[model samples]
Target: MLGSAGRLIRAVVDFALPALCALCGRRLAEDEVAVCMECLTRLAPACAPFCRLCARPGPRPCGWRGGLCSICADHGRQFERHRAYGLFEGDLARAIRLLKYSHRRSLAQPLGVLQARVVRADYILRQAEIVVPVPLHRTRRRDRGYNQSELLAQAVADLTGRSCTPRILRRRRATRTQTKLTQDERLANVRGAFWVGDPGEVSGRSVLLVDDVFTTGATLDACAAALLEAGARSVAAVTVAVAPAPPTGRGRT
Candidate 1:
């Protein structure tokens, strides 16, 4: 009886004030959730010509060696591999912004399910024994009231059938946003910022780190390094989107 009443109320409310796509602002169909199909189709997939180690889309830099991008070839990465669902542009970027800044927490479900599809198709990513979300600093999390990555991680774990272990990783300090920082500065800022709360939770396990975006990969690298130091067998990363490489003479995006 309660279920029927709830459905009726939702139906009336939806009819009166239909839900709209979080990205495009288009009215959602009865079957659709947070985003419209047209907006979703506009989200470009992170396919080919990308760095194998870090999954940075586009051509490798000049003098690239060892089949890795110049950055990876030079500094190397702590994670064994990384994958992203789409390029960070257009609808995809908007969708992430809605979830992260606008507090449209509902968007995390669809975005994470989409990311899981990418993970499902990759044999390497599918082998993740456990899923972990990058941790937010305690103060920041308290201010936000929720961790966006943790919400995404839960959805991904549900779809991928992996255990979501969010409490195992800890952010020791809050760092400034990487938005305008240089690549080197971004690395330095996040370095030693993460730690494992319980090494036994990640020890001997293949952890798949989840995040909203992959920029210069400094944050992911830092998290992966901490996981590895805690005796994790391997660490791989997945994100909803990957920001494009910065233009010449520009700081990291």
Candidate 2:
């Protein structure tokens, strides 16, 4: 069809002229990927000594005995484990904001590929049989025209040779944004907000939940809880970034 041919031509053009860096708008060099080498080096890599349960930076190396953090120890999380590519700060955070809020869906592919690399290196993600992105409410999806998480999930699935099920989970109710809320408030807002479209799709399977950012862990917990309730054997989380815990209080790990 002519439409299909047009699409193919567009794809070729895009491949020929990849967009510039979302942060700096600089043309990437031949040796560079989505981001230039300078920006990539500036984005701090997450080091170890993180919580085995949630991947948040911790005070000391986790022991295999429990491998849990204070938050996980005090309040058990529904998700089995979590991992992220970097801390939510500097250029990484700015890039994510552009992708999520600025309607730059093209950025998802490169970021998702980066996340896939991180997940592959982590043992928890390697064990997952399926990947499911956190769903957006219908209203939000309509406004945004695309789900950033789903885009990331698709890229990750392609890179890892895994299945990306964007619709296995659905947002059952629209809730207020979590950005302005306290930790407990955020949990309350998302509680009972998600539902499984087909429980059998994930029955007895290990799932990797994908999201753009990990702030309070409330959103991931809510999604993981729904998946477990729908018969997923276990759920691990992978995010592009994890925001540093606030200074006054501890963070969920």
Best of the candidates, lDDT: 1
Candidate lDDT scores, in order, read 0.85, 0.83
Clashes of 1: 0
How does each model score on TM-score?
A: 0.89, 0.85
Residues 1-253 of candidate 1: C-alpha lDDT, one tens digit per residue: 1244554675576569868988778888987778888877777787777888888865654435756776788999999998999888877888888788766777898899888998998877888999999999987787666789999999999988989998899989999988888888889999999999999999999999999998789999999999999999999989999876786523433
Per-residue error (Å), model 1, residue 62? 7.5
- Per-residue lDDT tens digits for candidate 2, residues 1-253, read 1244554675687678766776787997776556776776677768877777787765555453377666677777989888899988888888888888766667787788679988889887899999999999998887766789999999899999999999999999998887767777778889999999999999999999999988768899999999999999999999999876565454422
Candidate 2 residues lying further than 4 Å off, grouped into runs, are 1-18, 29-34, 58-67, 248-253
Q: lDDT at 3 for candidate 1?
A: 48
Best by TM-score: 1
